[model samples]
Target: MNGLSLWDHLSVIRDPCQQWKIELKLADILFLTIAAVIGGAEGWEDIEDFGHDHLDWLRQHGDFENGVPVHDTIARVMGMLSATKLQKSFASWMQACYDVTEGEVIAVDGKTLRCSYDKGKRKGAIHMVSAFNAANQVVLGQVKTSEKSNEITVIPELLELLSIRGCLVTIDAMGCQRAIAKKVLDKGADYLLAVKGNQPSLEAAFNDYFRLDMFQQEDANGYSIQEVGHGRKETRLSLVMEDLSILGDLEYEWPALKTLGIVGSIREERSQPVKELDITVRYYISSAQLSPKEMLEATRSHWSIESQLHWRLDVGMREDDCRIRREQAGENMAAIRHMAFNALNSDTSFKAGIKRKQKRASRNTEYLSQVLSGLGLS
Candidate 1:
């Protein structure tokens, strides 16, 4: 597989084009798309422009026998390609590039690709469920569902494809299902699932345990952290109880339920009045037995999927602004963004943010080649 080069790793996706009608190769198109996207190309035209401008650089890795295809042809072919095939190939490529460490936190979350919705076609927006390796700051894999509610069903499916053994998988309350918990256990990984109103009895149990009058300070381990940043001062307190007797028979329902945790956050913005300050508490259930400090870190680490993956895709890459809603195009393009993000984020030599790194890559072919080299290209 050419040491898992972008072209070789993605070649496993069967080409959707008819053999007799084929001009541009599938690998060539995908390689160009991913590289161009990494180099700050936003849409089909931008990708085509990038290809024409860097044909020589691209040819070093892919066989550009038919030259760069037109933007319309690129869009047509990309829209016809199978998103599932691309996702699988993408996961395989990630596995080749990065190794998941034992006990690492794998945050699972969903994001809506807003502009992908086609009101004319009566198709809703595409919601992507992604597994992000928090410590490594890279996307492990992703699956797209037609509706946000479908995340519960597809998350387990996405988890099925990744090598998550010995990792701690964290999800918000939407994924706090017993089946999902069991699935995580089955995958040889532990789960740290949030608890909310959806699980009435479980939420009540956690509430009762921490109730002001009934709470026993000695029964739980506690940790606290404070931060001052972005014109705000915040403090977080994490409390975890390892004793399952608190749940009585309710504990029997959750698979490998070893600990229960809660995080209380107090925030004060510089511009906000005292009354406008924020204070909130969130609950979680976990299969891993962790100390109060470890629980606090793990719970906080879960948000990296938002700040790192989702936020970067939206703000850094302008993914939500892209209006590519053609058949399978939205989903495939999302995968390409993830691929580009992984390459950019994994390259530590630049010592700059993703946006800056991308800008540099777009202007400097040498820096761009360094970025591609991280993906084992050339």
Candidate 2:
């Protein structure tokens, strides 16, 4: 197929013309979509400049049909698109471009577009919940939440939208609720949740039961422990305690509490050394009884959501500082940015930072076209 013909597949899902009364063909819309993201088109005007500058190359690559629409048309079409419809279409595209891996680690995290807040209107910024596949580095789906609601309320809805069978789901303290744990189990997936002040009773029970003195006692069987201090942080650890007898009197049924742990870390600066300690206890509810290595691997995989996904989107891609707050445009644009980031990350040859990759693609139309072609978005 030619570079732009892939849009025909997506057109079956949503017709831009019917939705927005735009006269452009699917190819034009697809080009603008890819260009807007990869070209660093902050808004409609940037997309227009990108299209106008790349017109000759676009025409050469494939049939232009009615030719590229002006920037105003691009803005109008994007503005007119129903956010819900766009999200659905994006989800469909994600499922098409990527396949869910068996035993995949799907991490759920929430982010707020800081610049998306409209202070004049006294409204909260767009806060979105994103589910990411840690292994494949692909976004599974995203849901927008009202400013007042926390991630706890939206996480279940996001999980309901995904097919997570055989996947390991990880979440922060906010999601460490019984209802959420039941939801994960009901979906045929295992869960590893971090304990914090929110579950004070559970935290204290786990801590008191696994206190340091308890490990030094004669009854510490089938339990191994290890500790590490690096970069001015101290981490305390214990492993593979098959028995939960110490936690017998807890009011809640923690059948999933196969292994419990506590981590404390301190930070030191040039001027002063600040001591900070956090007592975190977690429950590992899995279909497969994992060995110590397997459990540790799964627990460590949690940081991929931060290192591979969130960190990249914020620091690498500058997503947090984006100032596009028109209706759902900010969230919609952020989703597109994520799609672009995944596509770029999957391309081994394009190995620079996201900004550099985007600049290189924008400066070289052939490279940009090739990247989009691989994504089935040409």
Best-fitting candidate, scored by TM-score: 1
Give a tens-digit lDDT track for model 2, residues 1-378.
123333544455454457465467655665576666776666667777777788787776556667777766765556555666556656666666666766777888888888888899887888888888888877877878866247888788778777788787888788887888888888888777777778787777666665545434565442343454444443433344545565565534653545554332223433445554444435443334556555556666777877888888887677887777766567668777876876677666776887788888889877787777766765
Badly placed stretches (over 4 Å) of model 1 are 1-3, 212-220, 270-277
Mind giving the per-residue lDDT tens digits that candidate 1 earns over 184-240?
A: 999999999999998999889887877532223665568778899999899888887
Candidate 2: regions farther than 4 A off: 1-9, 12-21, 60-67, 70-72, 213-240, 245-288
Clashing pairs in 1: none
Quantify all predictions' global Cα lDDT against the true fold. Answer: 0.88, 0.67
User: Residue 20 in candidate 1 has what lDDT?
Assistant: 92
